[model samples]
Target: MPKLLASAYKELLLLTRDIGGLAVLFLMPLLLVIVITTVQDGSFKTIKQNKIDILLVDKDKGEVSQTIHDNLRTSDMFNIIEQSNENEAQKLIQNGKYQLAIILPENLSNDLNLKIAENVDGILAKFGVDESEDLPGTIQIEPKEVKLFFDPATQFSFRNAIKSGINQMVSKIETKSIYKAFQEEISEDSNEEIFDTESFIIFKEIIPNSGKEAMIPNSTQHNIPAWSLFAIFFIILPLSINMVKEKNQGTFVRLRTHPVSYATVLGGKAIVFLLVSLIQFALMLVVGIFLFPLIDLPQLNISGRLPLLFVVALFAGLAAVGLGLLLGTIAKSQEQSAPFGATFVVILAAIGGVWVPVFAMPQLMQTLSNLSPMNWGLNAFYDVFLRNVGFIEILPEIGLLTLFFIATTFIAIIYYKRKNAV
Candidate 1:
């Protein structure tokens, strides 16, 4: 017990003396979280609070074209800039002056109405309602295309959304035209309305709640947990470097003369670094809770989940420390350990949904992400912060992290003993 405490004290002293390492561990992550959160918050607000600029070229100058223009103008999503020349609109889109443009074909309204009227007449004659010999046996109407011009830089998802919206609007207009044609044929003498144009089915979004209030996750909620986990795992870089330094300096040789096991030495390093990880997490929470709102970002709400958040952080720290121990044991020098540790952490973060979300990734990458310890930690953090889950709900992720720590630490111990054996 005395040896373990003394070893922990020595590790603490070494960490405190390295000012640059301490700065890297603490300051860089704080800045990263703040900047990333701010940028993402702006993106989140783009569709809801800001309008996209779109050019409308109505070549038809008919009821259909006018209706399309009116719909675009009325929609909160688009800021319509009417352009008379289709060629000019296309130029503007290609030059990136505008993100999108919609072109309605000439005589769209007339042709659409004629097609509907002819179809209705044919249907009425089939039902024996129209007995007139003047009814044509065949009907033909040329198809009209609505052209969409998009900026080259426009995202595929945004383009798809715009295309879908325009298609839906045109379909509604076509349906209304059909209804009017039928009404005119069925009841030419009546003055009352026949068809209801208003939508019957509407979509409603349901958010999961904890019997109190719904915990809607914003950028702050997402960035804080994600980047904090990143910062925690990044401890491996310095931790591994420190281990390599001690070996290079003959500190390990001096410690061998004492009555100590390698596990005790590992335990000492784990205790100090675990405390550092917890402190790093706490500082991140402080910044999210306090600094974000001042910068016009949403405040992070930990509320009753603080304890569970810490529990996940603790286990995540253990996993990080275990990885550091293994890397340090295997690596022969500081140059080897430092680069590998940093690069490996980045790879883990990339695959673990730290940069891009798991759901957004391809099927193969999503499958591979399960192998990362950072993914486990990130999931556990999200379960507490966003999902508002309890300890029991987060047990699976916590269990995985615990097993990772045990396995890595065990391998590191075995490797160290084998290498130094008489």
Candidate 2:
């Protein structure tokens, strides 16, 4: 038993000596908080910094066509790049120099003219849609019409601007086309009556339900869970490296010869690593709750959700330790383990939406994220942090994670036993 305490003390000292371990335990988590907060600064600041670079290719020189180009360029949200050709514009967009490319067809004027004629003919031929002939002369052309091309990943404000711009252009085009037909009619002296008309275009609207007042979960709330899961999961690498260092330094073998049962040895080491992981978890939770407040964190209320939230954080840490132990046991040296451990952590974090919000991810990638612990952990976090849920809200997540921890620990033990036998 004396040897066990000495070995545990030795393990703690070895961990202290590791500069990287010290950074992970004490510094990196704080840095992550600072980075996440200061990176965007604030919403208004972000919007002010946000401007979409659009590549403009004006293949058509017609007044109407140029009007479309002019309108888009005059926008504060869009910064126009006058590229030589569509090919160059597309190259710039692909190279990430431009967020979107606007391609104006050489025959856009002709197309507009042709469409207007068709529309006028359709209206005149209608049975009861129009009955009067008070149609006005030539369509009015605004000098500020413009077309826009947007990068799919452009900021939300810019995207909305683009949508508005599109509607504005279409409405202007439709109005001008109708007026041109009326002008032709006035010049030729129409015999029958034609009705004056104005109609609104049926443009579609997209509204994201923020539910800020109602406290319902929204798309952005998922980021809190995803980021927390990945951040906690990443602590596994430091934990594993510490374990592997102990084994390589002959500390593990010396502890193995102790009079205490093997179970006790394993239990003590697991407890230490679990404590280390929990420390990291605490840092993340503190940063998440107090420092970089997410958009819609639920108020700490009468809901018994704090316990569930803590459990979620705790279970996530435990699962990470189980993974780290498995990884550490499989590698004979820290050098051998570091690469695989780091790579696996990165891949999982990326898949779990730590690198980018899941809402921004492609559908296929979003579906695939479910295979990682990041998904379940994030779901549990979101349930508490955003939904203001009770313990029941996270029970399924807790149950699943408990099963995962047990399975991973079982595998780690099996592999370690096999390694010992060898």
What lDDT does each candidate get? 0.92, 0.66
Q: Which ten residues in a row have the lowest lDDT in candidate 1?
A: 206-215
lDDT, candidate 1, 1-422, per-residue tens: 88889989999999999999999999999999999999999998997789998888887999998888899888888898889999999999999999998888888999999898888898998898888968775657789999999999988988898899989999999998888888887886656679887888889998766675657888998999999999999999888988999999999999999999999999999999999999999999999999998999999898898999999999999999999999998999988998999899999999999999999999999999999999999999888887777899999999999999999999999999999999
- Residue-pair clashes per candidate: 0, 13
Error of 1 at 127 (Å): 0.6
Candidate 1 global Cα RMSD = 1.4
Instruction: Give the backbone clash total of model 1.
Output: 0
TM-scores of all predicted structures: 0.97, 0.65
Report the lDDT tens digits of candidate 2 across residue range 90-162.
6667677677787776666766776677567557746444466565555554333344555556678676866
- The numbered model that scores best in lDDT is 1
Candidate 2 segments exceeding 4 Å error = 1-14, 17-20, 40-118, 125-227, 288-306, 357-367
| Ten contiguous residues with the weakest lDDT in model 2 | 295-304
